[model samples]
Target: MIEYFKSDARLLSPLYEFEPGCWVNLVRPTSEEITHVLATTGVEEDFLRAALDPEESSRVELEEDQTLLIVDIPTLEESNVEQDESKIFGTLPMGIIVLPNTVITVCLQDTTVLRGIAQNKVRDIHTAMRTRFVLQILLRVAGLFLRNLRMIERDFTKIERRLYDSLKNEELIQLLGLSKSLVYFSASLKGNEVTMEKMLRGRILKLYEDDRDLLEDALIEIRQAIEMAGIYSSILAGTMDAYASVVSNNLNIIMKVLTVITIIMTIPNIIFGFYGMNITGNDLPFAYWWWVPVVISIGGCIGAWIYMKRKDLL
Candidate 1:
């Protein structure tokens, strides 16, 4: 879908007409829609297709007439939580093509930052300038990464508590899922940082000094996100290991208690078996005496207590 917005105001007209500060937001546009955008704005077809490809590497390239900036944006599948490993959650391809008169964005899925920008929540004073718009987009992406990092941290905190309360295999699986998400985010953020740095120093975009400062701020945010992801992953891995060990120890204790009980019970069975055997002196000794049972009961109790105390099962 193609939507046009001018500084926080949505335009209803199909015709692309706007003053200096407008942004054209594209979300999951079809081929014909992409052709229409390019036809209206004079953007290159290859540039648009490059942004549409999911496997496109994050980079910034300049053609004869326009600059193509491809960056990785962290995205999660719908209805997916941090612990859903089977869910599709990773970086998506997002493209920004800066033409002389307009700036066009292409992405496979919708982005919250783009929506916010179109809503005027993130105001851009220079909407007419494509380079400025591109920089603003980069800033928005960096902000999104930071937001995702915070969310991951909060999730880790909750899961960590659960791990301590009751360490189970299911909880370990959830932790693994969270760790995978963090790893994905970290790699994507690092790639984005490199692309932004290239844009800053390459001067292909010819960004103004003030815009350069904005890009620098975005880079810093990306770096912070990468660092936060690393820390969270490390902490989560350590917690998982510790919890697994704890679970194993608990199982060992349970098994030891059951084993000790079985051993104590077997002592009485052995004594009864010997007396039950048909022997010549068995009847004369104490076979019919009630004291024999009493003696066996006392011995069993004493043996069980001693074994339990020695094994720390009591």
Candidate 2:
């Protein structure tokens, strides 16, 4: 869908049709809509497609009539994946195109950043100030990354607690998924940082003092998020390794105890087995007693228990 918005006294209002000096927001536009936007706005189809691609990286491009800025935005995919195969999330690309007459944004899915802006959540917003408006959007994207990163970390913490009580494949799977998510966050955040640096260096977008400050703030947030992702990934790796070792050691201890018990129990059987064997000339006076075997077995058990205790194998 294509949404048109115009500035009205520093606030945004929807427009029925395209007009000069307005913003055009496209969310998973249909083929006809894409053709119409391309035909009417003179934006190259490839430019929009690049941003719509899920695998697109963050970058800035310059054309004859427009400038294209592609950035990775954080997105969550909800699914009923089995506990073992759960996943955290990934990213989608968003295109921000600045034209001579209007600003155009294209993305495969709707994002909260656009909705927030439309709802007047951003202070001092105006479509006529295209550069500032784009910067504000960039700031919001960076902020969104941070927000989602925090949630990921929280999930990791919860799983970590559960793992401490008991290690399970399900918990490990969750940690793995979270680790993968951090990787995506780190990559996307770095890509966005690069794009912002290019914008700052190329001077493609005019910035006032406030715009520069906002851009810098966005960069700071991105950097912080990158650092967090790296740190969390490392910590989780170490934790998983440690838990695996713990599990192995625990199994070994249980097996050792069982082996010791089996050895101790076999001693009485060995004694009885020897006693029961017939040698024609050998007989003890107590051997005729019916309780003799019982006495021997009891004695054998006591001896084995004492020996095991002394050997510290109990």
Candidate 3:
């Protein structure tokens, strides 16, 4: 759907139709809507469709009077199955197109970055000031990254606690999912940082003093988020490796105990087998006594247990 929003007295107000100096927000627009936006806004078709592709990397492009800036935005996907993980974090591309007449944003999904502006959560928003408006959006995106990264950290802690209590596949799988989320956040944040750096140069988009400061703030947040992603990723990877080693060691210990028991239990089998043979009791007085083998087996088991205990294998 496409919506028109223009800042009136520094507050966002909805418009029924397109207007100059207004913001055009597109969220999963249809083919007809895309065509209409292109014809009405005079934005390049490529710029309109740039962010629709999920694989699109963050970058800035220039086409005469128009500037297309693509950045990665954090997203969360929730699972409904009871056995599956509930939250999975990822990223998607959001396109910010600055035209001579209007500013446009296109994305395949609605994002909190846009919602904050639309909801008047951001201060000093002006759709007519295209450069400043774009900076505000970038700042919001950076904030969203930090927000999601913190949540991921919290999730890591929760899963880590569960894992410490019991070594279960469910908890380990959740940790793996959290690790993957950090990886995605890291890559996306780096891509966005590069794109923001290009804008910081004041080459692709014009930047006034205030606009430059705003962009710098966005960059700082992005850099901090990048650092956090890196740190979290490293810690999670190491934790997973350590857990794997622990599991392997535990399995080895269990198998050793089972093997020792099997060996000790074989003593009774051997003694009973000899007595079951034909004419086996003729040469021995106690050979016919069933209690003799039973006593011997019990003594043998005790000795084996003592040996194993001394070796620290039991």
Q: How close is candidate 1 to the true structure, as a TM-score?
A: 0.88
Q: Which digits, one per residue and each the tens of the lDDT, describe model 3 over residues 1-314?
A: 99999999989999999999999999999999999998899999999998999999999999999999999999997643357643679899999999998999999998888987899998889999999999999999999999999988887887787776699888787887888788899999999999999999999988999999999999999999999999999999998998899899989989998999899999888877777777756766597577988898899889989988998878
Local distance difference test, per candidate? 0.76, 0.85, 0.90
Candidate 1 local Cα displacement, residue 88, angstroms: 8.5
Instruction: After the best TM-score superposition of candidate 1, give how far the Cα of residue 266 lies from its true spot, in angstroms.
Output: 1.3
Q: Return the TM-score for each candidate structure.
A: 0.88, 0.91, 0.96
Between prediction 1 and prediction 2, which has the larger lDDT?
2
Evaluated at residue 280, the lDDT of candidate 3 is 50
Expressed as tens digits, the lDDT of each residue in 4-123 for candidate 2 is 999899899999989888999999999899999988888888887888778888999888868999999988876344743344778999999999899999999889988899888988
Candidate 1 lDDT over 1-314, as tens digits, reads 88876543333223355333456667888888887877777778898888788888788888997888888898875423444433324788898888777778889888886776665566544567667778888998998888777777776777677777767566666667678788788878878888998888847688788888989999999898888889988888888778878888888989887887777778878777777677865564676786886698678879778867986775
Native-to-model Cα distance after best TM-score fit, residue 276 in candidate 3, in Å:
1.7
Clashes per model (N, Cα, C within 3 A)? 2, 0, 0
- The residue pairs that clash in candidate 2, if any, are none
Please identify model 1 stretches exceeding 4 Å from their true place: 8-22, 78-89, 281-284, 311-314
Model 2 residue 312 CA deviation in Å = 3.6
Candidates ranked by lDDT, best first?
Answer: 3, 2, 1
